[model samples]
Target chain A: MARLITWCYKNHWMTLTLLFAPLLLHGQVNCLIYDAASGERIACELSLRAIQYRQGSRNSQLLFDKAIEVGPKFAWAYYEKSVPFFKRGLLAEGVSLINKAIDLEPKNYLYYRAYWYFYNRSYAHCIEDLEELYTVHHESFTNTPGGEMEMRMILAMAYAQSGEVEKGIEWAQHLMDTYKEQPHLKGQYDHHILGVLYYLNNRPLMAAAQLEKQLEVNARLADTHYYLGLINRENTNSTLAQLHFKKAWAKLQGEGGGHSPNIFEGFNVSAQDIEGML
Target chain B: MRPVSYLPLIILLLTFSTFACLQSQANHQPKYKIPIVTHDLSYIPFDPLLDDPNFQICDSTKISSGRNRLQYAAGRNTLRSDIVSRFSPQSAYESFNGYIVIRFLANCKGQTGRYRAASLHLDFSPAQAPSNLEQHAKEVVMGLNNWSRATETNANAEYSKFINLKIKNGKIDHVVL
Candidate 1:
């Protein structure tokens, strides 16, 4: 013991550094993070962001797969892998992966969001997940800007789709009013979505008004023109309908054209309606 | 040699063994290394919200998957360059402008086949029309076979894409896909 003390004293700086190394190293570590598999976790997050931005779903899938291979116990990897599958229209594979994710971590609210809200398109199930996250846990997704608004939008859409049009309108109206003056928050509030909700409520005039308001903001969209055309056609205004439809077709041939058919547009207006009626 | 003389050697061996054991234990323990993120700017994806006009449904507006859009854009740019090299500006009326619309199926394998060209419209208003401008445009378009292959996530599905070329003053003005 005396000899050891003498040696430490002789090399005090080195000894001190050795003694404090573990403390300094571990200080920045997040307790919530899986310390054993941080590399995989980072790769997983990068892959998720890439896929979300449409960077390359196939590459993202491979990255997710690699993450899972490295950290087999990571529940988020399975959840993320399911996203690419869903994007690719492989619903069965996506559902299976989501189920696995939920099974691995039953407490994860995002797993439920992916399965119920995004994949199933069941408003009730989506609402249940949101309610559970907001009421019971309140630990997920409340910190980000517009997170609360997004929750409200989902709930409003859910209510509208579930035959509670009045409740849905209440939420939708609140959203629109809140973001009305904040034109920069266009990423959050969508007039087309609000217009669709009004249409679902069987108020065609109100729907047209909402969509026209969007056009006033920006009229460069062919989809909006086509939608207005459909609304006018429904109102039996052949002249306005034809005008909008012709404009839509002309815009479709413009510089930024060749977009996919709107899934929602298929609900009221068919491709035949555009080609034939126009 | 005296027995005490071997004690120093024994202590040195013990010290070495201890260090080996400590390293092995460290190898088995959980290591938390900070992650490093490197962004590659070359593979940036297209933002569809700019084109789709439906910013609210941004996720659904994704017509093409991932790097395919970037590749498609690159291909269209190449097509414009190709047309510029082939199309003879002197053959058309001075300052003449027109558009040629062509539709083709880009199959799952990223191969284009069975191209169907639409009727060519010449917009030489006050300027006299060239006799064989339509034929020249058709030949130029039909000669194009070099294209960047599109990647589709859905198994064995074909995608049909339209290529619109705006020709002005006997040179390709813009190529829209």
Candidate 2:
């Protein structure tokens, strides 16, 4: 090695010229992983983390641009960045990013889950992702208490949305049973999801029961009253329906009125619904 | 002749009374109150057209992500709730629905300022405009600190943000970002 270095030192100008010639001609400084589109290197973990910090701003989009510039192959960055775009109502951009993320990491169930729900709106795809995540790749994701509960909720919703009522009911029941032991964990959203699932699955009695459970937990939600009114109306109980509707109306119009923040994307419960009933 | 003398004295008294009334009228001036919307400008000054596309961080050509967008909506709702909770208007009369639109400047550093009411279309049961609610909205907007700033090249670049608060009856229905 020493003899070779000594020999190269005598021909340093030639070597320098050869290196400069290619760089000048190609207009490319060779990055280990170059992205032709962005004329930059691929992203790494650090780049992805940087993007996450700035995720709160519109500038985060540009940081995503920069992340892709540094590490185009970093699938997580694409997934992380897609969420903000979707929240901002840029569905197309979000869809494209999630797709790229999934394509790069096809086995990543979280990416698929995001893609199906946020980008494609296909419940079947969501079911597929959830099943694969739970059964095939259970060890991959961090299964904290909150994370596990959220996963179950997602699975339940996916099944319900995909017309698999029985499976949806089973999962929702599983969720209820699991959390029932811990009273503090049984939140309004849990009942809301179960109630919604039962309603969509043609189980009115069960739906009403679950919705009523929400009231027991906390009666502040305008949604609970509105939904109860809807269920009563379906049962042809005009007086009961009217009562619930009035409650909901009061809650919405009165000083202490408010709705649950835990809302699903496609499931809409609005004040307009109450107005239409009245 | 005595009656004629009394008529002169009465005429003089009437003239004095008229002059006193005119003087009082001149002294009493109508007081007009101009409402003020408070705001903080510690980072950058606000621009008139904060939501201009050329200077916006999230412009028409691009979009915000789903999570960030959701968070922004939630933040705006919280602000609305804070204002409404602090000064809730009465809602006993009839059904009502409308909105209040506010425009403000948010720079790249996430600081907000120069909050102005774009429009206020609130209707209540008693049929009086809720000046308190409107003021609270303005105060909330002005009180808002570091927001995610626009990434536009201009250092003083501001993103124009609009918060449309929908009210049903006297309660807050929802907020549109």
Top candidate on TM-score is: 2
lDDT of 2 by residue, A1-278 (tens): 99878867866544554554433221212344544444234454344444555453534555555777666666666666665444433333455666666666655525334333522234555667667666666622222112223455667776766678789878768767866565534444668778878887788898999889887765766777888888999999999999999888777665364554433544545566688888
Q: Evaluate residue B115 in candidate 1 and report its C-alpha lDDT on the 0 to 100 scale.
A: 43
Error of 1 at A3 (Å): 75
Q: State the lDDT of candidate 1 residue by residue for A1-278, as single tens digits.
A: 99999999976544664674443221222324555447656655544554554332444555656666665666676665565444433333445566566555645634244233422234566566555655565532221111212455555666776688777778667656756675433422256557767877788898899889867655655666777887899989989999989877766566344332322222334344468766
Most accurate candidate by DockQ:
2
Which number leads on lDDT?
2
Model 1 misplacement above 4 A: A1-75, A99-164, A180-183, A230-237, A252-269, B1-177
Q: Write the per-residue lDDT of candidate 1 for residues B28-127, one digit (tens) a residue.
A: 8321111111221111222454222221221222334331432443444466667668877675444555545444444445444434333232310112
Q: What TM-score would every model get versus the actual structure?
A: 0.42, 0.46
TM-score of chain A of each: 0.56, 0.63
Error of 1 at A255 (Å): 6.4
DockQ of each: 0.01, 0.03
Worst 10 residues of 1 chain A by lDDT: A140-149
Candidate 2, DockQ to 2 decimals?
Answer: 0.03
